[model samples]
Target: MKIVIIGSGNVSYHLAKAFQQNNIPVSQIFGRNESDLKFISDQLQIPFSTSKLNDADLYLICVSDGSVGEVSRLITKENCLVAHTSGSLPKEILAGNYRKASFYPLQTFSKSKNLDYKEIPFFVESEGEEDLELLKNIALKISKKVMVSTYEKRKYIHLTAVFACNFVNHLYARAKEISDSQEIPFDYFLPLIKETTQKIEILEPKLAQTGPAIRNDERVLKAHEELITDQEQLKIYKIMNESIKKMYEL
Candidate 1:
């Protein structure tokens, strides 16, 4: 099916590349910035436009959450199906004369990092059965895992993802900061982090709990609190320690 991708940010960059790799027909890529559009156009060898947006079988809007409604209003195509890659936005936000849907990819996108689309889970929603099937078929072309999800369910998934991915990544950054303060290489925690994640892959996180908080080792916890002099880090440590204690009823 012919497609036109909107925006030139990380999601747009990766999605367009995946479509190109799969030999999908991309009529054009559109954006407000001519230079950004030109760069992506040259990188993917696909024609791009800053003013003129072509009509296609499907249009994927990969812009920011705040701009999705504004961009959707700009698409003047009458019959073409339009979808956004937002995890939290409902399909109703694309309300207009044309068909609307959501084509959310449940993974973080970075332009520099190559992603295996085949392994990424895609959550799709459509207004009609035909359009839904079309979205599913298109998702299947790039990903082995595709699921039909409603806006309500998708929002919760997005919320949990914030905890699992974004918050956890911040914690990793905090750990690196602690290590850096002591002149210790962050790599020292690599094995521990790897094993912690690997354990959760086969066991529930609650079942795999360990450390001073879970073990109710007050001496160790106190020692750690003393070692962490940074107020922000100390606050986070105490909060997490209390959370762990509550979780395990230690």
Candidate 2:
């Protein structure tokens, strides 16, 4: 099926590449930024446009959440199926005279980082059964895991992802800062990070909990708080300490 991808950000870039890698026909890409669009177009060897859009069987809008509705309004094709890769936005946001769906991939995307699409879970919703099945078929082509999720459920998933992925990454940045301040390589924590993630694969997070907070070692927690000179890091440490303490009823 011929597909037209809109936007030039990380999600759009990765989706375009994944589709082309799987030999899916990507008719054209549309974006306001010519340079970014040209870069992707050249990489995929597909024609791109700043103002014009080509007719295709599917249109995947990968623009920012705030712009999904606005971008959907620009697609004039009434017969083609349109979908957006937004985790929180409802399928109704693409309400128009055409078939619409939500084709959200439940994973963080970065243009510079290559991802295995088969490992990414996709959450899909559609206006009709036929369109939903069509979306599932497409999703199955790229992802091994696909779920039919409601907008409400997807919003919760997005919220939890902010905690699990985004917030956790910020903590890693803070860890790197602390390591760098001591002239230590940040890679020292790589194995710790990997082990922490792996533990949750087979165990509940609470069951896998360890460290001073879980052990209720107030002296150690206090020492850690004092060691963290960064005010923000100190605050975060105290807050997490309290949270972990409460979680384990320490």
Please give the TM-score that candidate 2 achieves against the real structure: 0.96
Per-residue lDDT of model 1, residues 78-158, tens digit only: 888999999999988885678999999999988789999999999999999999999998889999999999999999999
Which runs in model 2 stand beyond 4 Å of their true positions?
none
**Each model's TM-score?**
0.96, 0.96
Count of backbone clashes, every candidate in sequence? 0, 0
Note each model's CA RMSD in angstroms: 1.3, 1.2
Poorest lDDT segment (10 consecutive residues) of candidate 2: 91-100
Cα-based lDDT for every prediction: 0.92, 0.90
RMSD of 2: 1.2
lDDT of 2 by residue, 21-65 (tens): 887879899999999999999888989999988888899999999
